[model samples]
Target: MIQAMYKRTKIGCEVLIQQAIDECPISTIKLYISRYYKKNNQRWALWARQHSPLLLQVTSTNSLESYHSELKRTTSSHYGLIGACHKVVALDQKQRTDSEYVAFEFRTKKISVMGLDDEILNEFHKFPYPIQRMLADEICAVENRIEKGKAIPGLTSLHCNCLFFIRYLLPCHHIFHEQIYGPTKLLTTNSWRNFQLMFEESGFEVYFHNELIEVDILEQTKAEKAAEN
Candidate 1:
């Protein structure tokens, strides 16, 4: 129950914690919940307002720490300054290439919704490609449930009861199920779309700036050589 609570947003956590307080049989568990969760709830719980869409899938900082470890590994006693610099550049390029490839695949590849019922799949198709992939994953994870409630009306007022949709602003399995009953527009304000937009807007500027700098440096070097001659 505690672990489940940790995965929920602050509002959801409060609801679950209250349920635990009212129904939990174990005295020690109730005591711990009352003391730690009830008294100092906001300090520990992940509030929806504070959460970032990019980090909704992230559980810990271990991945970042691992990347730092790998970066440190690129430099050692065996490597000179130039060798370390070259290795760093190579690693950076490889990472950038991998990122571009992934983005390209995301943009180009057709998402298969083979198992989904025709109605549901048709609604799913109305979304953008990135959203389709995300919804597909969510739909696969949905278990059997007697769905209750009406579909939300519009993008501005859209919401899903599930934590993923609440925290990340992506439609969850429940929302998709709701969509079957009544169609709702999928909003595209989440981090994934933002990243795609940002890249599309700024990707060329860096290369253009770099080429200009290189040309200026070459011109300066040539002028210095001519003066010496």
Candidate 2:
């Protein structure tokens, strides 16, 4: 879907993508706006449609031949059909979630994630290109119901979503805090106990004393047994 959207936008257009943070020549980035007339109005939104440029590129003779061939090849391949259905569902869920979250981030810039690590940090950097391109393309694609006549929504949302998903959501859901946060997010038993003690001393109610006592006892028992040996 990303590839198709990209191709559709790039087929007969020139899109300007932002330089990566490291590659950025200047500290401040200037915005680019589209100036096409009808592109500025969403009044004709019903006429706007996304289509496969690949389909348009195929020669008429070969295209019809391929279409007929594909139609002729259709069979009761139940397993393949089921797999295709699953793929569609997965893709739909992904696209829906992506668009929703992107839209959300567009509205709000701040997002939080719990876990972080080197692996996730690396992957976060990698997925931005196509993401930025798609966003840039979308911004240029939609000129109706939008002001400033540019892809600022796409640009800002894409960057924020990339940062939020990579730094927060992925870490919270997938990576271990130990890997990402290293020593910061981790709490040793002693540290936790100390924190609880401080909380209690400060008149904050905490209910994990029993669990902490068990941990303390287990630690003491292990130390005593090792010393005796």
Candidate 3:
């Protein structure tokens, strides 16, 4: 119950904790809850609301650190200034090419809908790309009400109760299930289109002015000295 409470919104969390305080059987549980969670529980759970949207599938920075480590392995302290510059330029070019390739794939490839029913697939297209991706990745069944045993009917009510959906304004996996089984439909929004455009335009060089004039000057000076010798 405590862990579940942590997953809820700030006000929802407070309400649940208050309920727990009122009904908990053990005095020590009540005392601990009052001391730790009553005052500023929001601070602990704020990241779920703030970072979950941007995080997507990543839950930690370990992958980023691992990439940095791999990059370090590819570079060497023994390389001269020109060699280092060339290496950096080569790596940058490779990354740019890879990014362009990914953008191309995203533009060209159709999302697979082999198993989804015709109705579900039609409804899926109504959602933005991010929401669609989220639904595809985290597929699940619609949750039943504990008291009623009836499935939730639509995305709006599910979105209201779901912390992830509310925080990000993206459909949660549960809502995806609701869409599949019920009359729930994800509405089209400018946010997804804007996001797609932003991603497609990322790393595109708007202006390319050469900034290696100092290196050019040094090379010119060396050439002159060599000619004189």
By TM-score, who's the top model here? 1
- lDDT, candidate 3, 58-160, per-residue tens: 3468856865675677789998889878877877787779868876654454455556656545544544444455555545334333235765455555354
TM-score, model 2 to reference: 0.17
Clash-forming residue pairs, model 3: none
Off by over 4 Å in 2: 1-79, 110-229
Give the residue spans of candidate 1 off by over 4 A.
1-44, 48-59, 118-130, 141-143, 146-157, 181-229
lDDT on C-alpha atoms for all candidate structures: 0.59, 0.34, 0.56
Per-residue alpha-carbon lDDT of candidate 1 for residues 130-217, written as tens digits (9 for 90 to 100): 6567778887755343344434333333465566664445567665554444455343335335423433544323223221112587
User: Please, what's the RMSD in Å of model 1?
Assistant: 15.6
Kindly list the per-residue Cα lDDT of model 2 for residues 37-155, writing each as its tens digit. 22332221211222222222221477447644544454335648777666556655765797788655443342222343333333333323323333233323333323444222222
* Descending-TM-score candidate ranking: 1, 3, 2
Each prediction's TM-score versus the true structure: 0.52, 0.17, 0.49
In terms of lDDT, the poorest run of 10 residues in model 2 is: 166-175
Worst 10-residue stretch by lDDT in candidate 1?
204-213
Best by lDDT: 1
